[model samples]
Target: MNAPFPPAADVGVPVEQPMLVEDADAVAWDQSTDLLVVGLGGAGLAAALEGIERGLSVIAVDRYACGGSTAANGGVFYAGGGTTIQREAGEDDSPEAMLDYLRIEAGKVVSDETLRRFVEQSPETVDWILRHGGKLAASVWKEKCSYPPLDRFLYHPDNSLVASYRARAKPAARGHRAFGRDGKKAWGLGKFITEPMTQSALRLGLVFHRYSEARQLVVDRDGRVVGARILSTPEGSPEARRFAKYIARANMLLAALPPSIPLASITIALGNHYLRKASEIEAKARFSRLIRAREGVVLSAGGFIMNPAMVRRYAPAYATGMPNGTLGDQGSGILLGMSAGGATALMDKVSAWRFINPPKAWAQAIAVDRAGERFVDETVYGATMGEHIVDYRGGVAWLIYDKSLREAAFRQARDPKLVPFQRDVTLLNLLFNARKAPTLDALARRIGVDAEGLVRTVATYNAAARGEAQDPFGKEAVDMHPIERGPFYAMDISIDSRFLPLPVITFGGLRVAEESGQVLDRAGKPIAGLYAAGRTAVGLASQTYVSGLSFADCFFSGRRAARHAARANV
Candidate 1:
């Protein structure tokens, strides 16, 4: 091992002081493996699978169970570079073209070389998932939607279709959602990917410890990370047995009841009770075990959006947004790496999504700030609009529309093609929450915006709709409906709006080697024997996010870390 380097300064106060580094020589190891993977989420599963493929003995630990936030996701895997699905859909896309768009979206968060490598590997990444039993439909959905409808499995989930990005590169649908079985409900489509990958890893002799959390990194005298201290509930323990039952019931309810059903709230609340009980039992029964990793310790435990303290400390602006990850997404992996001298980056970046489409007609509505000034192209990606509202508009905005536009949106919400959740939420927002008034000034007053400012903004927008001037925000003419009707409506699309909750995910964590996914210190040098992947490490979406980009990066970065660790000399 190399000589010990001085530990880097802590990246603010963590949710709690990370267990940091423990002297390897002072610990008694209960188990050992060539690679120790923390948090069996998408990234950890990928690393474990990859490590097993490379003939390395791997052991994985998860706080709850396998899946993590990935299992709760919409199952979209952002892939381009002429993937088989793209070709099957008759879409022309290449690594160069993909890079052209991503360069702008990613904004130099990663080196050009790293970004190019990511794009180049994208097609193979899709293939790798398929090889591991993950499914992607060949059909493409060409629509301007926040997310594809249940029947559609492929779409563009980023800024690629927007005018600005279309000019930079030919737009193509890149979100490849994992195929669900017939009669399957919408939501949590990610189970198709995570479940199969987990089974594949298990079948390949990967040792997994559920109800276990990695608390600290174990480092050799030379400051090389070699293992971890895991707190785990033994499989046969009373708490573990009870947790299995609770979690099984919870999963059953989650699978059976989509959020759109009115009774779903009560059933889901019961499911949450089971989950909470499971967590309580797990916490009570945990006992620490020292596990040595001969080659490397991979931290893939996800991000910190669920950690209130971390959210408030880092991306405070998004503190009020609903967190979108599992309970395990509390920055344990990132903090574990930080304790081992890992440098963090983009800690302030968060993806606060306030999607306004699905009832795609809603995109025609002009969004205004508190002062009633139009701020963004209504048809832009939801995250872009959300950023404008939260970062620039004091976390408040309203979608202003005439009665005709509102009616159109309501009609579209009734389309059978819309997912049940989307349809229900849209109907709820429009039918119950939308404020109606006789005039623009009255509408502004009803929604608590500047009345005169709203009137002027609408006049300017209507002139553009009538072809008297260019659209100020470059919104397409097709999405420009004049708001001159006497009956006007304003729907709150703000970050804190009760009717339209914004789901947020943190996009920041330990800075790592772009090539190998090795945790890097403040000096930009890789820490020997330590690696990080997924949200625990800064990757493609650290700067700005798009749907499926995080999942794709999980595959790319996880495999990179696993392969590098497997080949490294201990």
Candidate 2:
């Protein structure tokens, strides 16, 4: 079939991919290297750099730019198994503990071999990042937080939920943050990762082509992914606009990204800030440039968080919340893996919203459903609340607080004990959903809940707070406080956060082999010359989440795939 738009050749690019071209007699490869990488996010960067460190020729490309979703994130890399950082911070964590903890999160899909590799190779992966421009500190945090609260505390806090898991490993700090410069400046965690990784790729002499889109995977008669079709065009062009949809419908047509035009712009930064302007690093394309992968192709292009169709199909409940991914996370990577007979797992799994922890003071507040009756132990981590609300309350719940609790919430918002929080959103929630009433009945009427039920719930809670009766929900006394004082308030801290959506990322995608990071076929076989990493495949957070686990998996899976791919043809 002829392309609707006739394409032309992009200049100054050589053909480099590790597979045999079907039409080698007639078609000329735009660029050729031992390894051709698509997507320059953390996974892609890690993959490219891993190949380079092994002295293999490498070329990498991204649809938008080098930095994908990671650039916009608070880069948290989860690690443990007695790493130097953990040791320095005076925390004892064994590999078995990390495996135990992760097994619960990843569930049954990931193989035991993969879990072992993931736990065993984690420290080496950290070392690789450190050597190649990344930075992390060795300090155990003292407080319990969803994400890093005060630049310390890398491991998961000993949450009561984790304690209940069948694996039953004692909680330890494992999330590693990159503060960039001296490792003390707490700013862009993504930059700490993207900046260093990008520069390392450039320094290692890997060819980088930005603004080049991989439209489809080139398959030979043998039904294996050989290379990608490269297409270079304007961002909002008719073809580019329809690319994602077109790719999904006809997955094969989407894998290949042809060549592109020259001299647009190449922006580089040596550190946290922009270093200086330099020459343009361009990838010229004439027609859809067909560059064969001599070894293999990796899909680390992120998840489908931004794709409403995928969200609605997999998890309908999350269709209307704030998506925590970039414009490029349209599931092209997931689809690409699928198009090549790759079986996917956990597509239905998503962290629709993560409440984490709002404030220590708010722990004493009572959370109620539409009927105005307390259901959850409000003392649990905020991040853990979303699932319960979705399963039981249909995604909407209210946090009812007394004046003391409300005032403390405000204070904690201003000056958090563990981490600086978003005071604006907190205020917005209080200002909008919160109700101030002289009595529990009036507050219930104002908040649209059962008046009698609200009054009864409060009286029971107050009695429990006063230690007159055994607490019905097992809430510790430290988390108990009476709502006897009038002028009560309520804010809808539902899964959607009524005021603001709790930021969340999808944690499931294509299931790849743990040992090789190879994308597996539906029948549980490795497709030769094909692999996946990061959110593109099911890793670290196979289902549930632990702050930095996904990011750390990005680096580990990328490095793992590259380590195997670099040796695939040799």
Candidate 3:
């Protein structure tokens, strides 16, 4: 019988047709398993491992290598609520306190009950990760930083330390960084988290298909997802295997270079060349296979930040920012779920990070819009700052700093405790892009802001710093420094800056049942035998993003989906 759906193509565009193939029985299945997982990222690895532990046979597939965007991340897992590491580090915390803080951060994105459940299970979740060979240091990093240095493994990655959040609930460092094997590399720490779990899953009979893309959902007449149609490079083809090996080798070579290395751009270009060659080979050798998922199908394929068309459609404001995710995060999983009648929520929500810290002095400076009006607390988390800029300030803003703050930031850059990546980027922005003038009026004119407005704003800020008035943005006294010294500077922190790129990630996806990880339709009904985890689902970070929330949600939702799917009748 002819397949109902069109043949999968490598068009480099978002899948538009939902790609639903009904009448699963008519199609010839190449293989069968208890659960079929699409996209072997953090969530897929977790789901596969959990399924195998529950004695269910599982098969997983990914568009690239086994690691997706997760492996490219900082490897921070946000877990608190009296976790072993938190207690070991001499921090006092509880589930109620966590929920109270998250209630503000998470907002009404999830129900009170669902948020409570996540908070209550936080400690156990850390324990589970530790059991899987994931290692985290018990030492707490007590400093204001966008991300901790390579040697430090624990820090606060959210607004928990802000005055308002601390007033609501006690603050504690919850970002549990995975122990990285490569000390010099600032990123790819997520490998430490995924590699161990992936190894465990592989040892327990989880079959993972690399360079395979799931293009369509196979559903029964009852509207139940039964399997998936995957386009994969021929496993036995020598040429395809050789190209795959080349891609892996290139990635390893790129990972060895430090972020501060001058030859980094050339190496990155060469790596892209190898990836393109491998993609060409994979495309030519591609063949379709139908994998019957007897129990259920879990979509852990990650978010669509890398998909330009989807970004244009859902979040046009963030199109100028640097897309932050691997090639596999092209919204294929969300598209597959939609094809199975899954409804998506929070499609316009994107996390564009403009981290102005690591040299905490920079954040103490006042951030002004094009009109020279102060908009937000300069010391808030990067996501909050980025949101205010993109959503409210017309994607344009500048950080105004005094000579003392600039000098202090330069001194902090010299500190050995700073991450090399952060240090290099900070120096580049401060040295090259910052516009300097003898006075605030001259600085405002140089940066194309209202001169009078800029002068007035700085005067108000100075009054507050002098203890004569209250800060309009509620910035704490310690962080409020008067910009009175001459030679004021304005650094372009806009979303579209080429030198200082704002890394963006999508925070919206298929809406799922809170209790079970089942994908829900428009009418709020679960799409049977279909589930989603990680960025593919509207989970904890769908509303607002912190550094480690998505990774934590991957573990929570992936395990939830697998445990529930394992009980399904096969």
Candidate 4:
């Protein structure tokens, strides 16, 4: 089938298609465009925008809508707060400093060249978004936030741009850690949703295909990815093979692959079912560890919850019917990159969202686990939360509590879930009004779990806390001691996968070449014209995801990919 619009060059114009393909095996075929982007989340949008800018025929699709991660995020933008760090340390904030910080933080995980590239391109990416239509708010945050909050341990040669982003960002800007009371500077998702980021992209002639998912990459036996097969949703009807054929024939075959295992670890680390009482405690203990290491923190829970609601309203079918288990959109981008021969690495380390603490909406139910006992601590999980959400034996974690814990957390912990309480909220809350029952026995009986096992688990946890016996999970990372005291009782809440994991957005996906945005293999070979960024790329921890980094990476990688793909046409 032919698109309604003719080729760009046909309209008395001279626009060129970059990687135009000519295959007939795809489901819904389009061979006219020079560049074909499979996923329309952050990476896809960035790629398409660059393709359009470069005057290439661009056809981008998502198994869902165009606002893949953007629409779902709290709209936080990041740049390495090098300048802020330098100024605070009475040193100059320079690009060199930023690079050094990344090197130290990445700790041999990423190359210094890659770190330099990210820092160098960050300003350009943020500028592009601002010029194009995205709004940003900024604040001078000093506390340890996402990825260590701009550590001063590393020094760079340049200092002009250390904190330039604070001024560069638009009004109503917020701190990166603003979910908490002491947050100094940054913006939140609420403000971002009302902003014009997506509208700006659309205004630039960007086209969005919502509820359209990329099923698999079409590759020849040689391992080159031609294009992708897209279904409207997990349950939605798949597209015709003709379309897939068209994509394959038009674009030069590139690499494809899945998300790096580290990205997967983000969700896998957070125990599937978050128990209210103990989950909070576990979250805090892990959070402190990250803090001790000077890593940044962020509250991703609300974004995960609310994005689906927005999608359902904006793209209803795509919102509800995707497959379960995997984190974020069946990882179509992951699969597409894999099929195209993109490399997947970094499965050992997960992102920090799961460990930071719970967001305000879900804070009450997010219990921390201390040793085997539950304790209340912080009310938000930033980047660390991803690792905390994975499935572990006994589904256990820690929550540490002191005299100040309840006074500080009790009120905020009771906040409502971000999504609609009934449709997306938990049965436990719906049934019990979100209250923490006195004992594990009562709570287990209420949730219909094995009460004996539950009691035993609680007893063991209490014993471990009191130093009476060792914890079964050997939870050495716990902070709070004995759970015998009334005021310090830690509650464990089972993290139900159905609602919590429902919207774990895709971050840190397949690894791609920095210069070309070409997806790479495990061995670090380029996957031809294939490229990736955003959550679809690997080595997120390779650099501090300071304010604006996610959005910055998207635009930078997308532009690089388009430019390289277009140049390849020459």
Candidate 5:
């Protein structure tokens, strides 16, 4: 066995700490809520807030702090039509048009009614966010969705660097500078949304509990869901007792033990791995297994911790023999949904990847690979390279080049360090003095490729580049232009997971009737008092995404779910 790697020293960065509650010994049942929410991320918070607005007592809980992925994400909400497509393109976009777009995008998986509801309520959801002090950039962005060539149909709040600087310059007093004087977007974490949302829900009379891990759903003999049995620890406090009493009075029974375990630390959580013991990972793995049961079980857990086996079983398209290194070896959320009797209809070959802070070596590698490679317009490649970086297949790709052409490109961008997104490189340089190898051939061999074949491939690609379009291999789309430069370099590069198929904020969730947010069985019959929202329900968008639309759908559905839940036993 290998000795565990030395724990990395911590970097000082401000982060909201997780709160702990101890002591589960109270018999007092202070109140009964109309709805119980399992997770407190975007979906749960939306539901609780909306439920409270509709005059229902809502109970929301989370194992971790409410942030989950919300706090960690680049605060870019892309709600389509509201800003980008309609405002910029001057296209006629109505509720029907948006619904049609979503239905077609979801590949017939989502009902027309549901799609329409999503479309109609999306604008309202955006307004609600604004109403709650969330800000948006005035500039609208036209982007892609699943509807073929007509992909331009979304808008994200401006999140560019200039915009960030502008926001920072303003004092908190002017109230979220509606749009920077100059209408541009910024690409950084805007503010602490999770905290504000939690505070808002609490102020609105919704109850929220942290550190409560839901184990299973309790169903009566007739398969009717009574409540949930959550396994909680008595961290020892008066608040903990009150929380326990709330659970007991609800008469919730434990449905299944959590079974999915964290196999390895994801990049974001790597900083804190030393604190995570084997037992902790094992407990999470146990909780993951509860997703397999047939009744009253809904996995609202985020998609980051899916099981690989379950992904293959439910989302088989991702696991089909696609050559190793093509896909990640471990899986997490896929199993959680499948085990809980959730059906993944669009189980196709979706990419599993993420893009975070780009590594320094990669900027150098990309510049080196593209040097002297005369293919399509260089500007197009430059503009779309970010997308390619986000969906990088592996940490490496061959830089096929003939000896001569390479010299020309290198002379232009002599220093690889010129690229702006070299924060990773800045850190890497501080840690290691890795020198750049002079020749492409040496780099190719280092990154693992047929050295001789790489030379020939480069020569061929160069010849093709002379002609208008390069080779048949969609060079522009994948960002792989034939690197036929001398002294070929094939430096190791890292792929970002951002552009890949993320099931976490899934478009599809529980099969709910469009009007009521009611869960339906295989035969389309509504399950009594059963409802789903957020990623727990399936089929919202397809093939492509429109950014903030999912958030809008979640807000709308959460509000709708509360309305229906309040009227369920009425």
Candidate 6:
């Protein structure tokens, strides 16, 4: 038996210290609200909106500008089980099938009840978003469901991989997306929803404090969350501090010479003098404002994908990748909750996406490992393929295809029925990296894989493509085939691509109750008056994340937490 490598130390992410009420009796309180919502992205916006709708005073803060990764995502919400659009389109769907599929993909991280609620109430959530100016062009439905929760309202294929793993779930496309200018006008992504949400929250009277980073949760001696301590820089001219004393001396003489001075000039001079004194009193000013939440504090700050320390401590595979998160996604919220005794889970799971499912041109080719052997089902989920390649195949692989298949795909490029919209982007980019050679051996060497192994794999696959034998990998030969024809084409598709690097996100976070989005302590008890939602708290995507699951969890959990916090005891 062989021994394994010793595990690395938990060089954890940095988090600010919590302000104890007993220790800080002299700090000035800047704002007091019923609910304090941290972060201004999808989850934080949702919480602030819910708090406002419930008639609770709300103050929301963001470390940077608004618009987190939610605005810049593919924007498909996996709503299944005969949602309003599915029913209107007369697409057959059942909650049973959705539950089966989701249970398989989601594994055991989410409680059945919460997953069920997410599936069932999704229509309501969609409607709520729309009512508040969000958009979803549900009138259009595609054949294949992109992610899980099988229902035909979306546009992607069934989960054959899950079924191969022995989970009996029917296939259906269940992604519901907003309408925007990004794709075909019918295929809007996350921005269509997140932008309207931010606008609505602002219009509904929620106080939004931009560029204010929450450093710590304020807890009382009894372990109840009272508010938050935010780190911010005062928004003023720096020149005022430089000229304070000069203005003060001029103001002192202004009273004696004011008879001939204009009123406006006097007012301006007096304002500058006060600013000067204020600057003197606040030299090298430290702006740490205290925000008191009368009822509760909802930590909706995003996940820690941008923080290298957190990535190193948790999922080191995610330590390197193109981040799909806001700059403020520094593990602050998760660390804050943990410092308050919150427990966490699935911190090691991450999404390393290499979108190879499209251009179906790539599908006709086989992804070969260093040994020149096919590793995964080409038609399987893209992220799963990414996992296999990164985890098992040395973080790189090559896709070998023939000219005939490429020609076929090029001919069908304009046919929307045969190809997804905007897949040409990948196809065009691939042309720059695609390599060609006369023989399989020459091509294998050119692409840097094992020539002998490539010859064997190609010869056997060619025989199958030519209808002489069945494919060992279960690939149908209708569109793919026969490397017997000369002029072979191969493209390197791996965890790293200079033109189009693989993007990733971290989904694990602070553990919370299945019923409410309350932050849970290490002892598994709720931290009084402290709640969390979005990627900052573990939810539906605790095990395997898909396109819209994070957004859906944010909306649902945000509403749930706000509902509980609005009426909680101070």
Q: Each model's TM-score? A: 0.92, 0.80, 0.93, 0.52, 0.57, 0.80
Model 1: residue 299 alpha-carbon error in angstroms: 0.4
Output the better candidate (1/2) by lDDT.
Answer: 1
CA lDDT of 258 in candidate 4? Answer: 13
Model 5: lDDT to the true structure: 0.39
lDDT of every model, 2 decimals: 0.83, 0.68, 0.84, 0.40, 0.39, 0.70
> Model 3 over residues 429-529: C-alpha lDDT tens digits?
88887899999999998989999999999999999888899999888889888998878999888997756778899999899999989999878899898
Off by over 4 Å in 2: 1-27, 148-167, 181-188, 233-287, 373-375, 416-421, 450-475
- Candidate number with greatest lDDT: 3
Poorest lDDT segment (10 consecutive residues) of candidate 4:
289-298
Q: Which 10 residues in a row give candidate 6 its minimum summed lDDT?
A: 1-10
Supply every candidate's count of residue pairs whose N, Cα or C atoms clash at under 3 angstroms. Answer: 0, 53, 0, 145, 64, 10
The digit string of per-residue lDDT tens for model 5 on 69-90 reads 4333334344443433244444
Considering every candidate listed, which one attains the maximal TM-score?
3
Report the C-alpha displacement of residue 205, candidate 5, in angstroms. Answer: 1.3
Worst 10 residues of 5 by lDDT: 252-261
Q: Please rank every candidate by lDDT, starting with the best.
A: 3, 1, 6, 2, 4, 5
Tens digit per residue, CA lDDT, model 4, 1-570: 101222323222111222223442432443334566666655566667776676666665543334544444444444543333224334334565455544544436556776687777654665566566554433243322222222112212111122322233222111222122113221223134323655655676665544343444444344444554434422222332333332333211110111121244344233222222222332232110000000100001111212233333223322322211112333345444544445655422233233222222233222433233333222322322333433232333333233243443444335342122222222332233232445655554544445576455556655765677764434332332433323332333333222232222323356766667677776778765466666556543433333344555565566667778777665
- Model 1: CA > 4 A from native: 1-27, 182-184, 247-276
lDDT of 6 by residue, 359-446 (tens): 6666667889878898866766666667777777878888888777677556645555432433454556556767889888999888
Tell me the spans in candidate 6 whose CA falls farther than 4 Å from its real position. 1-14, 23-28, 141-154, 157-167, 182-189, 233-286, 409-424, 463-480, 567-570
How well is each residue in 235-281 modelled by candidate 2, as lDDT tens digits? 55554444433323332221111011011112111210111111121
Alpha-carbon runs more than 4 Å astray in model 5: 1-31, 84-113, 139-191, 233-299, 304-351, 354-422, 425-467, 470-484, 491-525, 541-553, 566-570
* TM-score: model 1 vs. ground truth: 0.92
